[model samples]
Target chain A: MTTGSGGRTVPRERERPGLTPEESALVVRIGVFVKMRWLAIAGVLIASLIATQAFHIQFSLVPIYIICAVMTVYNFLFLYQARHLNVEASDSLPETLAVPLRHLLIIPRATSPLLARARATGNVHIIVDLAALTVLLHYTGGIENPFIFYFVFHVILAGILLHYRVAYLVATWAILTVLLLIGLEYYEVIPHVHLEGFAAAGLYQQGSYILSVLLALSTCLYASAYMVTSISGELRKRQREVVALQQKGLTEKTRELEEASEELTTLEEGRQHLLRFLAIASHDLKAPLSAVQSYIQLMLGGFSGELTDKQRQMLERSSIRITEQLELISDLLDISRIEGGQIVKEMEEMSLSQVVGDSVENVRAMATDKSIKLGTRMPASLPKLKASGVRLKQAITNLLVNAIKFTPENGEVLLRITEQSGDIYTEVLDTGVGIGAEDLPKIFDDFYRGSDREKAGSGLGLSIVKRVVEAHGGKIWAESPNPEDKKGRGSKFTFLLPKNLVIAGKKQGRKARLKSQET
Target chain B: MAYKILLVDDDPDIRDVVTMLLESKGYETVTACDGIECLAALRAEEPDLMIIDLLMPKMDGFAVLKELEDGRWSKYRNIPILILSSVREEASRRRYELETALEFNVDDYVEKPINPEVLLERVERLVNKNKKA
Candidate 1:
């Protein structure tokens, strides 16, 4: 022991708070056994002294002295082992003690062969050792021995540390020892004392019975305490697990909320940008419209006579150019609205042929003006696809308009609808200015037009078509089929849609028979 | 005698097209490439009507309109001003409603690529309207 700055003397064993619970508990139990057995050693010494005075039992004092000497030596040996055991047990404990306890118990069984043998023997070998020790003690003194009840203490200790079967074995050994003493007294195997006075009457019989009852009662108490402690320890472990699971769930929910907030901020920024562009575009458009209005005012006022036919014709062309600019601005605004995720799709089953024919009719005047031959090839039995009719028409009309715009006079633009494997494949093939291979991939991106076709477009038509196709769970791609043959190398745009529309409340079978017939 | 007209715009191609159309119609037309030249031509020879592009370098169409309003010359003052641009309708409506303290007035607005028929019809109507007013 050494005194620390705290002024309290610290034992070498207690200096390290690192003991495993099982190792520490075993050391505590062994210490208690040593203390309890001291009283038994004293009782044996007193009994020998009483025998020498009352009966004048004269024999070689060597056996008596030898028994006392052996008891003294065993007590000192136990004390020495207890101190070392305390130090070893304390050196292993820490804040995280459970793993160390398991390691301490399990490692000794593997590293030390003797300890492994002892553990493998389980409780059966312990009971045999206790039986041998009790039989040796009985030979030293018959039933007249006062220290015989100490065997009960051994039984209770064995019951707490070892299995219940070992406790039962030890109890059987104690009962057998009493029976053997009774048998030896009847046979006159040593001097047997018979008590006669009231003080001595019933003393041997009552003492034996009381000691047996006490042993059984203490065993039961120890077992109940062990059971309660184990159950409470298990409940605490389960509670820690539940808390960890709840914390993980809360962390996941917090991450999802953070992602949603980031997306909302991005959308707000996009809205502000669009508003700024709209302001600038509105201001720039006014200049040209004002010019046309001013010129008409002067011509009509007749400040300089009536205009000739040539002057009238010149003014008509200027008005046409302004109208085209207004149309381009309106289309740009529509595309912005659709991309902002404000547009909702209303999908229905409709005939592909009719939609194509109607789109051609809408743009027939532009085709005639450009002298582009616009025609469609529809299979007699065409597949009806689930789609938003308005969006589908818009997409097709954009493709047709581009084909007519880029194709030279008398070039052919063909629209074909083909059915294959529960899908409708629509292809728009045109004899026009084919897109370069490099520009093919970026054609479907917003505001992306081929450099070759830069002057002719607002660059939004193909992007809108791609958006509509993707919304319907369809795919669209473009290809230049005849790159080597420049005259026949016009671009082909094709898209695929599933024949059956699987949406809410709609049956799986053909839902629009009347619409297909109209085509 | 055909009236002389001055056409001013920033785009060379648009200026060429308008010049061709106006000359083909037998009107004697003088062209200025931008607002600065349009203002210079206005001082040099006052035309019947001034057609100006809204967006340009050095000076813009609105600035030119402001200059016309500030000038005291009766030939340039009270001349009908038309804004030809590619801006949207909402802003065009707003520009028409804008009132300066000096009482500057713009006749009307038109968008591009200048529908020839509508351009002639609107110009003829505004000229007739100014005469009646």
Candidate 2:
């Protein structure tokens, strides 16, 4: 069974067969013991009535009648409990009945409150009632009783349910019951009354009864011990099977998880490859388009000396279309690379001032065109930090260009560099559209744009910035400088890089160099 | 005196653009659609320099360079070859210097869609160097 994300059981596989056919057959025999309880109760009751009438059998009729009646009630209770108890409950009840049942068997004429209590309760009720029936049989025919083998049945049932020690105790008690009955008959302590017809017809009296009692007692002890040991062996075997099945289940689950993880990794790799292709394509495409745009712009601006108003307008519209197309291609490429994990970082010790200056130079022309105030503040105390120069420049330039694009004419965009304990920080503070609180978290997500921004952007700038920062073991976050600083109070984007860089060893560097050289 | 230049490309548009640009810059230009046509043109006219695109139909630029290196025609072997294409930087760099034999030397490499100013500068340098040699 699998638990879904909602935590409900979903069926995954079916239950397997637990017990063999031979073991199942033993379970059926346990059923026979239950059936025999009822039959024995009925037999005892009928025998008692017959003895009173047929042979004018003389005894305390009331005591015998009361004993038989109580036995019948006990038998009925045992049957009811055995039928109702679930498997685990039934197994526990049998152990509780063990000692008391042993007492009942040994002292055949005795009764105890504990035994009576046990009789009213559990599967042991059946065994206790069966002991009572055995005692009655002794009264009717002494050791000559044909029903004496019922002691073996009781012992076998005890062996199947109780522990081995309990089974041994029960077997000993059964043997003692036989000895007690024979001793009583021999000593005449209890009336040596036997069934008149059977005793008279039989030639041997004391010898035959003693021998039959001995045989029955021995059979009961042997059978009980054998059943206890064999059933325990079977139970242990079943337990082993359950353990093995559980282990198999765990191994299969682990294999499935591994397979799923491998498949996910392969899919991720494929996505990254596609993203790389798109990024390269878009970058390459931009080269030619830029050339076309510049040539057209130059032509329209009368570098060729003059142009009509209509021609100028047509040129402007074409430029707009070409610009839009370029933006769309770049946005598609940026978003794909971010999602595909194509952006790899190379960590090295780099100067913050150099990185800032390079980024400024890259977007300087655009800033000039916008007439935006671009300034940088770098402290001489700023320590060199571990970072990827290309990736950091790409991210910082995107932020700077975004600022230059959005800020009004004469608006200020400041690049600030600072150092804290073992960490270097860079902040781009732009006097452009500030982001809203609700849009802050999702600003770093692919293709997300804040509603407050006026310009149409591909919305991939922040996402790229976020990826590059994280790849360099850094963090990127945004905050508005003030609530009242709406139009001029631009968003401040900050990122931190670790001061100490971990460099790969000589061998790995050599391998990387070789691979790059081969390409 | 105008310099004679041979331009080779599988793409007709690129060839037309480069030829037009070179001609307008006051150089005499000759065009070939493939390496075979280039070889045939070389036999008819002795150009001062050759510009070849890396990717081409029927016979590629590398094969043409290999043919030139093998000295099928002794006079053509000494001409300075300039590779111009949009092939990846690392691959192009290796193709130009690392893999080729000593005789198969490329004078310069320019990525496409060619910057006219850079192209003109490289062309002039190669033509001047060849004339001196």
By TM-score, the best candidate is: 2
| Number of the top lDDT candidate | 2
For residues A276-373, write the lDDT of model 2, one tens digit per residue: 67745864676566556545555554544578899889878877777766766665665565456544434456655677889999888888887888
Cα DockQ of the candidate 1 complex: 0.05
Please give, as one word, the docking class of candidate 1.
Answer: incorrect
User: Residue B70 lDDT in model 2?
Assistant: 64
**How high is the lDDT of residue A289 in model 2?**
69
Residue B5 local lDDT, model 1: 69
Which residue runs does candidate 2 get wrong by more than 4 Å? Answer: A1-221, A276-324, A345-354, A368-374, A379-388, A406-412, A430-460, A470-474, A478-491, A497-519, B1-11, B27-115, B118-133
Error of 1 at A501 (Å): 4.4
State every prediction's TM-score relative to the real structure: 0.41, 0.49
Could you give candidate 1's per-residue lDDT for residues A1-519 as a string of tens digits? 000111122233433355433334344444555554566556556755665666654333455566556656766765665555433423222213323433543422322322222222223323433443454344444444444555555455545443344455556655666566655654667544542221243444565654664455445434533553354336435645776777789999999999999999988788768766755665456445645534543453343369888876665555445545555665676576455543343455665666777888978998888788888876665555566666788888988887777777888788887768767787888888777888889989877878865455678888888887777778999987533335666888898876554233432224346556787
DockQ of 2: 0.10
Give i-RMS (Å) per prediction: 10.1, 5.6
Q: Ten residues in a row with the worst lDDT in model 2 chain B?
A: B88-97
